[model samples]
Target: MKTPLSRLGNSGLETSLLGLGTVKFGRNAGVKYPSAFELPDDKSLASLLSLAADLGINVLDTAPAYGSSEERLGQLLKGQRHDWIISTKTGETFDGKNSAFDFSAEATRQSVERSLKRLKTDYLDIVMVHSDGNDLELIERNEVIATLDQLKQEGKIRQTGFSGKTLEGALAALKQVDMLMLTYNLREHREGEAIDQANHLGKGVYIKKAFASGHLVSGSGEEGQLSSFRHILGKAGISSIIVGTINPDHLKQNVRALCQASAGMV
Candidate 1:
């Protein structure tokens, strides 16, 4: 069965309950997955995306920090562009093994433009700030939210938000943007209050690290995986849970889990 699509808060974007994260499509250098692996070749990535589409996933989450992920998606999703909701980020970049941050208004605008060029799209569906732990400072001091708002006004992005690390930041961001992406998983529920607040305000919420950053995934059995997914996706405010993978089997399994969890909801 195909996974169901839902309105992402009040952003007017319809996305699958499960969104595909594209970090593995472009980088694996500084990740903390249980094991180190080579980046998937183009052929493999194409197959993975095909499977995702077949399973009814419509959101693809990427960022400038994810190495060449945006570039690869631009190339591979050219003909199928209209079929997916492309979400990328600004404010951060990955240099093979280390990461860097820039939240200046100029850098934020430049990042969006660069992402547009790399994704081969004239406009992005969503562009979020990829925060480096200074979520509040980035918004209040650096004016990242204002910059994204300006870009949205300029027709460069359809929706805007931040992948915030702090609850205070997420809450503050909810008042300013159309969406908020945060870490929420079985192991961590600190963002639950923030999610509820976003939902109350009719703003979109995207869940990241639902599998505990791969540590729980590595340790969990099949039943354990199902329980974790059910708990996470059962929450009310989540527009989608973003999971990154280049493996077809994992993608299929994730879709199945989402289907099962959703069934329980209905």
Candidate 2:
């Protein structure tokens, strides 16, 4: 069965119930996955993208902190750019060794421009602020959000979002941005307030870490994954869950779990 689609609030963006996270496309260092793996080759990534499309997954979440993800997507996603809803971010970048954050207006603008070039797109569907745990500071920074607002006005970006760590910042972001990217799973619901607020306010909500960085789903097998998917999707305000996987077989199984979960819920 095909995955279901949801309107990302009033942002004019529609996404699948499951979105692809591209961290594995570029960088594997400093990640929290249960296992480490090599970066996928172009052919491997091409097959994965094709598989994602076939499985009805349309949303992709990436960031500068994700190493070369944006650039790889730019080249790999070249001919089929319009077919997917590209979601990227500013404020943070990951060198092979360390990460850096810059939410200034100049850096933010430069980041978005660089992302556009790296992603090889004229207009980005969604651009979010990649937080560095200082959620409140970034939300209230004014310069960053204001810069995003300006970019949206100029048609460089269609929607703005915040991938933050704190509930306070997430809640505040709903008032300012088009959507909120959060970490929500059976083990973590601290952002419940922000999720509820986004629902009430008609803002989009995207979930990360729903699989506990792959520990939750992979160990439990298909039934375990189904349970995890059901648990997250069962939540009221969730627009999509971003799951990162480099294995094609795992992607197929994940989508199957989602299909089964949705069916059972009905």
The candidate maximizing lDDT is 2
What lDDT tens digits, residue by residue, belong to model 2 across residues 61-179? 99988989999999999889999999999999888988999999999999999999999999999999999999997777648999999999999999999999989889888888989
lDDT of each: 0.86, 0.88
Residue-wise C-alpha lDDT for candidate 1, range 7-89, written one tens digit per residue: 78987888898999888888889887889999888899898899899999999999999889999999999889989999999
> How many clashing residue pairs, candidate 1?
0
Q: Residue 124, candidate 1: how far off, in angstroms? A: 0.4
Give the TM-score (vs. native) of candidate 1: 0.97
